[model samples]
Every structure is written in C-alpha cells, then in structure tokens.
Target: DEPLDDENLIDYGLDSVRMMGLAARWRKVHGDIDFVMLAKNPTIDAWWALLSRGVE
Candidate 1:
C-alpha cells in the first residue's frame, strides 16, 4: 500500500479476501491449488517457486 514497500511482496500478508484474489489469479493461469498450502507458506519467493514446479 506504500511506495517502495518490501513487506507486501515478502510475506504476502494477504487477508482472507486478498488471498482468495491471488488464488483466483493463480487458478486462471495454472489451475486450482489448495489454499491451505498457501497459508502454510505465504512468501512469494517460496510459494511461487513451488507453484512454478506445479506443486511437489
């Protein structure tokens, strides 16, 4: 929400609605994923890497 903020990308920090928004976006491109896994690993670098691998 602020300029040059590093917090947003690193932790995700997405609320229930916001996390759902991301889940929808990922689903559109890669298909459905369990939201619980995302909550367990909320970092973009970590989760995106996992998603890129189509989940392990």
Candidate 2:
C-alpha cells in the first residue's frame, strides 16, 4: 500500500489522468484546491504544508 503521506508521484509515474484523479480526491476533502496551484508546486511536502493550512 502507499504511504498515507506521500503523493506517489514517482512510484506510479503519473500522466494527466492520474493528476486529475489526485485533484478530484483533494477536492472531496479540501473543496477549494485549484489545479493551478498544484501544478505550480508539485511536491508532496509542499502540498502537505498547503493542505495543513487549508489553502485555497
């Protein structure tokens, strides 16, 4: 199973479809996460900080 805290960005080698899946999941929990910010910063640690702060 995947780590609860990681984005699996490398292990799975994401394409656009995988990216969209991730964004959809975040939308369910966060509701305001735009793909633009995620595209701008594509690291798990960075996203973790953003999620913790409830960023929009």
Candidate 3:
C-alpha cells in the first residue's frame, strides 16, 4: 500500500524490524544513513528528504 507523503508509517504497521531492513537496504546503495533519524519521523516526505540530502 502506498501511503500519503505526510502520513505516519508507524500508523500503517511499520515496525522496527521492517524499518531496520529498509535502512540496511538503502544504506547498501546510499552509503551510511541515520536509521534512527528516518525511524523518528516515519513519513514518506521525511524519508525522501533524508535520501535526497546530498543529491542535486
């Protein structure tokens, strides 16, 4: 299910294990990332911001 950008992912059943796996997968391609930071916000928009931080 695609969640709205502003929606809280935890509300949609996003648990820590899933979050960790996502972080691990993303890290493999994006380099080191703050998993806690992504987990803290738990929103699609926030995640995009984190992922696109250094990209122009």
Candidate 4:
C-alpha cells in the first residue's frame, strides 16, 4: 500500500539507515536537511515543506 502524504514514513518500514542515506543525498542540495530533522517528523508533507524551502 502506498503511504499518504501525512503518513509516517517510519511506520512503513523506513529505517534509520535509509533515512540517513536520504538525508545525506538531499543534504547535497538542501544543506539544512539532516537525519534528525527527518526523523523528528517522517512524513511526505513535512519533508516537502523542508525541501521546498530556500536555505537560510
């Protein structure tokens, strides 16, 4: 089943290693993106909010 935008990614088997990998990849562009930030709220909406923002 596909996760909803508001659904928790961790609930769908998104583990820390994968999260870190994604954070690392995204950090290349979105410098502020970190594992901790994603881990705090692992949802598509939250990530989109972060990713779409201009780095400060």
lDDT of 1 by residue, 1-56 (tens): 53133234434446767766777777766675656656665665656675687455
- Regions more than 4 Å wrong, model 1: 1-13, 54-56
lDDT of 3 by residue, 3-53 (tens): 899999998999999998899888876786657977889999988988887
Error of 4 at 48 (Å): 0.5
Clashes of each: 0, 0, 0, 0
RMSD (Cα, Å) of model 3 = 1.7
TM-score of each: 0.55, 0.59, 0.80, 0.91
| Model 2 alpha-carbon drift over 4 Å, by segment | 1-12, 54-56
Tens-place lDDT digits, model 2, residues 1-56? 55344554545564566667777888877788767657665668767876777445
The residue pairs that clash in candidate 2, if any, are: none
Q: Candidate 3 — worst ten consecutive residues by lDDT sum?
A: 28-37
Q: Give the best candidate by lDDT.
A: 4
* Model 1, position 46: C-alpha lDDT score: 59
Show the colliding residue pairs in model 4: none
Sorted on lDDT, best first, the list reads: 4, 3, 2, 1
In model 2, where is the ten-residue run with the lowest total lDDT? 1-10
Q: Which of the numbered candidates is closest to the native, going by highest TM-score?
A: 4
Give the Å shift of residue 25 in candidate 4: 0.3
The CA lDDT at 10 in model 2 is 45
Off by over 4 Å in 4: none
lDDT of 4 by residue, 1-56 (tens): 99999999889999999999999999998888899999999999999999989755
